[model samples]
Target: MQENFEDQESVEIQVGSEENLKIFIVNKTLLREASNYCRRRFALELKYEEEPIILNGFEPLIFEIFLQWISNPAPRITYDPDRLPQEPWLSNAATAWLLGKKLQCSDEFDKYALSQFVQNCAFMTFGPWELIEKEATTGSLSRFSDHWVAWNYRLAGPGRNEYSGLRAARATLTAPVRDPRTFDIEHWYSDCGKYMRPRCLHDPITRLEKLEEAKRPKPIPPAEWGRSTELRRERPQ
Candidate 1:
């Protein structure tokens, strides 16, 4: 019997510059499904028999995260205290989001990265608005930045209009607010009145619960007698 393409680890991805180049081995089927960029590249080739693909100007760490996203069953963007400090995590998340766009990664992967970035910003006293503005120069990212600024202004409310950037017009807007020196997740969580947790934080728990509910067979409706009877008749013993 012939081996399945999905099971073959035939793709080698080389990320980053010559000085700090790193190679990643990935399954061709999974890589093709996860990234449109890779799919197109593979299609163009007459015969791609384990040819190593080179990706220039990419952070090796970010690229690794992309690989993990495709390989794992349930991939998540999490902050690791040991590998990275809290402040840099936000920046990394932004980088990951940009990387996803560049690679034309699946919607799920891009959404997760963006959600992490937004949630990370919400937890902090202030965000790396300058960096976000700098990075989001065009396309969907630019629109996202604009929406983020508007959203923050609404959350800040009338009395808490201390942020100068928020007062500016959309076109003139630079950074949403000034950057903070430090961010304490515990402190942010504790102050419920001042800082409400973003929906993204609770999403994982709620999403799983919803998925479990969806998986289980729903009970026949008691209110609709005819429909219930029909359903019961249709069901196999």
Candidate 2:
């Protein structure tokens, strides 16, 4: 949903250089929900009725999406810049993109909030591994490494589709590394790959063949008594 800023509580944020700087008015709630930095700043200003908050060293477009996410009627909806047709796992990419933007803010509280967002969103979406793989591919380098490793500790959590978890892991292992987000992916691959391979289902062709083989009945062997009877009949009395 497009948020109509009119008639809502607004805060002026100073962005860019004085000549290049632009003042943008944003809704207090939108900022608070998306970023802890925005939340705290808004809290102080709301209490004191302070001057416009000055924020420097950030791009307008990134901030625009950051604002848009929280303001969205369907934040649960994955954001794709191209608005490409989504696959079942497309949310993974969207989550990765959102968390990446969160990292750019360079706020400790905001970072924590984004991490929490990922955790909660992953559970709700029933796609933790997709989120994990997405983190490696899209999230910040050092942060995502730690986050990806943390997933092994959360292996095959109940109520999740185990095959989907393994499939996501399969995607992560095979997907090309994007630095610095995935600089360590290769390093982590050997071990995580070992864990995932067995659990991930065989490809459709292999599975179908296996199923057919399993369904085919085995032929019954002839009775063992016939050979024994002939030997006994030939024996001298």
The segments of candidate 2 whose C-alpha lies over 4 angstroms from its true place after superposition are: 1-4, 46-49, 73-237
lDDT of 2 at 106: 35
After superposing candidate 1, which stretches have Cα over 4 Å from the reference? 1-9, 47-51, 73-89, 122-135, 138-140, 150-237
RMSD (CA, angstroms), candidate 1: 13.5
RMSD of each: 13.5, 15.0
Candidate 2 lDDT over residue span 28-54, tens digit each: 766666556667776777568568766
**1-237 per-residue lDDT for model 1 (tens digits):** 112224365667777888888877667778788889988877876575547787776778787766666777354444333333354445476777788777788777766665466457555455545555666565343444444555556556655443336422233333324221122222222322122222233334545677897999988966646878899989999
Please report the candidate that would top TM-score against the real structure.
1
- How do all models score by TM-score? 0.52, 0.36
Separate clash counts for every candidate: 0, 1
